[model samples]
Target: MIEQGYNFGYLDENTKRMIRRALLKAVALPGYQVPFGSREMPLPYGWGTGGIQLTASVIGPDDTLKVIDQGADDTTNAVSIRRFFHRVTGVATTERTAEATIIQTRHRVPEATLGEHQILVYQVPMPEPLFRLEPRVAETRRMHALADYGLMHVKLYEDIARHGAVTTSYNYPVMVNQRYLMSPSPIPAFDNPKLDRMPALQLFGAGREKRLYAVPPYTPVRSLDFEDHPFVPVRADAACVICGSRASYLDELIVDDGGTRHFVCSDTDYCASRPPLQEDAA
Candidate 1:
């Protein structure tokens, strides 16, 4: 209905129905990656085609939508996604996390607490946690069916042998409900905890990978780690240099030629919402 006036390849209702069916399967299977006939978007595949397609299916006239990339609305990919949605659906848009009914994100999760009414759609590059290790889907599926993940434990042990730590900073693998192994996407391990018992529904989609998965509110997801080394969420020791919020995950920013560094909250809404600190006055 949208593209007849604009250009070409505007997704038809049949395409929307196909995406909706895949979404239903994803929600039912939790972490299981449901294959979908992903349609091409105005934006490139890596940018957020899955997120946009999922958004297209679930959006209603009353929803408030927010889009962010690397914590900024003005980020190039975020702008492109938002423009496509605006042209197609004419949905209301905002930068405030609290005000949004649905949020689509790339590279970071919003730091503010989300409510049951909100939905989080993540743009994922790779949805399989075992892809790096096993490479073959047939083998990985058997491993999952048999509840086998000794290889994951062994990989962590090797990391300790070499790096003195796990060394994995993102795309940390976890067990959903202690039964199904799952990937929490490339968001730092610090953000993994936020997924558990969150008020809003969490959905992960990978366009290039042809996968769509979800984590319902209040579901259990535990990262794979050892008792001696333990799984450490990145930035557990670093506080935001700008907002002074210690709880939020941060992206390291190298500010000087001397290699001096600072940490900034990856959630733009969360950082902007924080009150001015005493350090800011100085």
Candidate 2:
């Protein structure tokens, strides 16, 4: 049941219809950014107003929602968004990646493999991959139309010249369907590989930019790189101290004032799903 005064999923029916139309265009075009009438939400712009709007448009009463910030379900952003939906839509919420029907994320994709039943909505601060290189919107759109990503390649080559490799750790540029260059939000390079031919439908929304895009299930997504210097997904060379997970992306935590550090899984749900280490009897 929806809250008393608000429409279902918070947005008005007409607004939802408009957003859905934009989303449809986005999905159809694969990597092209489709402009939409972005609406104001209770939250600020940078804190996922776009994702909230997308979720509001698509989510139904029976859908199970999950929101994660940088892979953690308990972060303030995640918790607040989860509670907001629960309050407004009375929808079921879960921390488990496998259980969620719709997952709205910022900065990181869930470590668990998503299936066809799930939709991954990313909160993008900037939708244009060429924005940093070319500030002019018109020029960027032209470049995208011509499939001219020379600027992006030059930028990457510059990184190699300075740092000895493509050192872009987050928001790495990718070529979608071999046609368009895309910004995969701010997700770390470690998660970039997961975007390639992913089973789940992926959607990106930028509220401040008023842009939306999509990568339909099984669409090809390739990280940009040279033949000699291929795209390599890098992560902390440590296991999760809590779950002893060696494969999941690890977050380094400063443990003490003396600078001692410990590593843990960024995906809290994935970490928790691992079996606890058993101690041998003494």
What tens-digit string does per-residue lDDT give for candidate 1 at 1-282? Answer: 243363222467888788889888877877777888887776787888888778887887678889999777778888878777777777788889999998999867788889999999999888878888999998988898888988888888898999899878888888887777888878777787888778898888888888888888888888888788777777756778778888887778899999998887788778888975676453
lDDT of each structure? Answer: 0.81, 0.94
The backbone clash count of each candidate, in order, is: 0, 0
RMSD, each candidate, Å?
Answer: 2.5, 1.5
- Which lDDT value does model 2 have at 137? 98
TM-scores for every predicted model: 0.91, 0.97
Candidate 2: tens digits of C-alpha lDDT, residues 1-282:
556998888899999999999999999899999999999899899999999999989999899999999999999999999999998999999999999999999999999999999999999999999998999999999999999999999999999999899989999999999998999999999999999999999999999999999999999999999999999999888878887888999999999999998999999999999887566511
**Candidate 2, poorest ten consecutive residues by summed lDDT:** 273-282
Residue pairs with backbone overlap in model 1:
none
Off by over 4 Å in 1: 1-10, 236-239, 278-281
Error of 1 at 198 (Å): 1.5
